[model samples]
Target: MKTMTRPRYRLAIAAVAAATALTACGGGSTGADGGLPSNVSFGGGASGAIYGVLATGMAEIVNTNLQGVNARAEATAGGLQNTRLVRDGELTFGLTDPRVVYPAVRASGEFADEPPAEDLRFVMNGYPSLYQVTALDPNIRSIGDLRGKRVCTAAGIQTAMLGELLTPYGLAVGDLSLSNLEWTECADRMKAGDIDVIGYAGGPGAAVLIQAFAGSPTAHIVGIDPDKATAMSAQFPWWKPSTLPAGTYDGQTAEVPTVEISGGTLVTRADTSEELVHQFLTALESHFDQFSKVHPLASYYSLPGTATNTMSDVLPTHPGAARFYRDKGIPGY
Candidate 1:
């Protein structure tokens, strides 16, 4: 993986999304008259990705169901930043990617030089993600095509994934004319034909790719070689087998075989109120249909699916969430 720097795109969610749904039964416990006295906040990914979108939906759901307990979503640089916020108790909850969450808790990988976040707690694990290599040029079709081409990505994590994506093709940073432009800048340059590929690692139907498709009606989503999927996963343990079904993106007529990543997670601090976590999970499960409607990528966030995917020997589920899963008979951490 290349040692690329993360970009600065820190913009807080200016306005809280208003909750529209009515509360369902079996929520959190309250004190004297109602819920908690003050408001709580949720941290999400950079504004454009699925994590940020889900965070906004979570806040709206919380505010809608539990009246006095206002919840807000904070837009962040993504999981690495959000995990620190949640671990330090700066955020009541956060939407994060497992790549960062696992390391933050264990102080491994990117966080090797830092102390482990002993306070981190799992809330919900969700959605399979992929390394979306979007290109405006029809000539660019696979990782091999990126050779000697100008490829751009912003964050270190995204760059690491990009490096891993290239390994099977026997490519490296020296094999291409690489650039470290911010994500938005990459998009702009790609549109201007200054960059051949704009790469990112996230769930399907990423907003940037959607806008790219709009900008270049015939823009293609360059896929990894299906034959190399297993070798790639073996070489990079974080990657898993993935496939982008036909119609995942507009104008995409055929399934694009790819690799899945270990990410798309919701986490909280260990000390956060169990009742609050419980209620949040309850609201999430009850109103999941509405959340799924917020973004096409959200279709991956089903209870059973998330439960089955979340459990790992490394990450631990929160006690509050564990109880919810146990009672519901969902087999997971």
Candidate 2:
């Protein structure tokens, strides 16, 4: 008979020991202990997408600040998926858009059973997303001019927000030939002359919008009337008046006023320890410049109560986060 494989048996035993150690350590592998809950996974948008980049930066910040906590970022579809994962405890944190958050909490929408995501608490708010309207027809200089044209507003939360924004202007889906297209599809359709107008809601520096504007020199960004924007804001409390500063995109010299909404919020489960959350916020505040270097958008992350323009939609601040805000006398929930 062949001699027993002593070396192989020893290797097998070592692997088992490692696995058991991981399981015994509160579902987290042994690493630097940051006085945090445990190892955490962050969920954001599609790979290399805006939210994906933001999530990656956040993970880096958290890992650097906390000991023993290995935070990893993962790519997901978008807001809706992120919210669901957080609710199911599949993710410790995530980045989400406000458009998706509102519907998720509403009684008539997909998250009716889940009700208000009471467990969902905000970590940070990102920049404003403008509703950009570009029309091929020279005569279509405003929202009213698209009455009889074929228009494409990318589907999902964006399409819904567009409908809400246009209703008071007496424009409805029936008023225009509508095409349900994604952002990339809408840009291509506009370039191919398949669509007369494209409505997009995104951050000021969306690549697709930049390309669309560059490709179609004749295309114009229809100006939204201030009164109309005000009326819409009255209907949707979350809507805010925002301006895309001059030169945000080529050939756009004058500041363009538009109805906007905040996107990209860092959220955590309600049960996450306050001490851990406090440490995370303190580290973020202390390292603002580091994150800003990582992503220009992160420049907005700072002390909550400062006079600098800041978003107020962060509804129920986490206890740990609230402590930091209160210490600064920043009004927060």
Candidate 3:
């Protein structure tokens, strides 16, 4: 296994510049209800990504459920960016992963120096995001097998999570030829044989994986070893061992065990009125079927215990959300 080198100074400088540009353009104004308009804006992932679609569907659901609120979903870089936007009040809401929320809240670890953006709160859990490790080589069977091979972990949060996911298996970025590419780019690289494996953490029924396997029948999801998966979960509380059942996609027949995490969170500012948060959840529960119609992933949003169970531990539930749960016999700390 080879280690990944630190990104060049030029790349770091460019990233800073890009972040500044985004910060400047992303912030929006608050609406009359102290909520952004029903046309409230949501920050989503890259174009054509599942999170992007999920955001659009959520916006539609919110807009349809509330009389004055109209939600609009916009493409974003991903979780870290969305967190920053939501904290800054640039977006009324956004979809984010539970793992990313932890470091940001602790104001240590990866997000050190940028203290936890305390204002964030959860609306609901979207889906389960399983870490899928796929390789073009049939001989590679586990995370450890790709020691010297080229591995593409999609950019931003996905890349960060992949690094964390491999730690317990004794694999690090240094062990493989690491390529930080976008999911679409990673899929394309895998199809071109430029990368030996692509590690992705995404909502169930990911289109990217489906397309990649369809393009190259040789490409397949390499199952994580159960013992390794269990150990990884113990090391990272946010991650739990999970499986993707067969029939999710063509040629994928057996349930593959892997480390899983909450796919998305509906977050809002802490200062937002409790009444508004309650109203939002009320609307969501009442029109779940309408929301599910917005995106297939929304089906998970309908689970009975979805809201209370999947919230990121790092984020304190909004007072509004806490109240709603308390009424239903789910205690809030």
Which 10-residue window of candidate 3 scores lowest in summed lDDT?
A: 1-10
Taking the tens digit of each residue's C-alpha lDDT, what string does model 1 give over 1-333? 223344343332322221111111111233554335356777776576667787888889889887678777676666777677667666777677766766787898888988798877777767778878888778887789888888888756777778888899898766877788766777777788787888887777776677667747768888887778889977766677788878877888998878887566777766666777787778878888887887776777666766653435466777778877777898544
lDDT of 2 by residue, 1-333 (tens): 111111345434643553343233332212244346657767766567777787788778889988877777766666777777665566777777666666555534667777676567666667667888877678887897878788887656766777877876998766778887667777887888888888888787677677778756677678788988888887776677777777877777788878787777767677766777777778878887887776666665666522122333434566777776777677534
By TM-score, the better pick of 1 and 2 is: 2
lDDT scores in order: 0.72, 0.69, 0.72
Candidate 3 local lDDT, 240-280, one digit each (tens): 88998887767777888888888877777776656667776
Lowest lDDT 10-residue stretch of candidate 1: 18-27
Error of 1 at 75 (Å): 3.4
List where candidate 2 sits over 4 angstroms from the true fold: 1-35, 303-314, 328-333
Ranked candidates, highest TM-score first? 3, 2, 1
Candidate 1 accuracy as TM-score: 0.79
Look at candidate 2 and give me any clashing residue pairs.
32-67, 32-68, 33-67, 33-68, 34-67
State TM-scores per candidate. Answer: 0.79, 0.81, 0.82
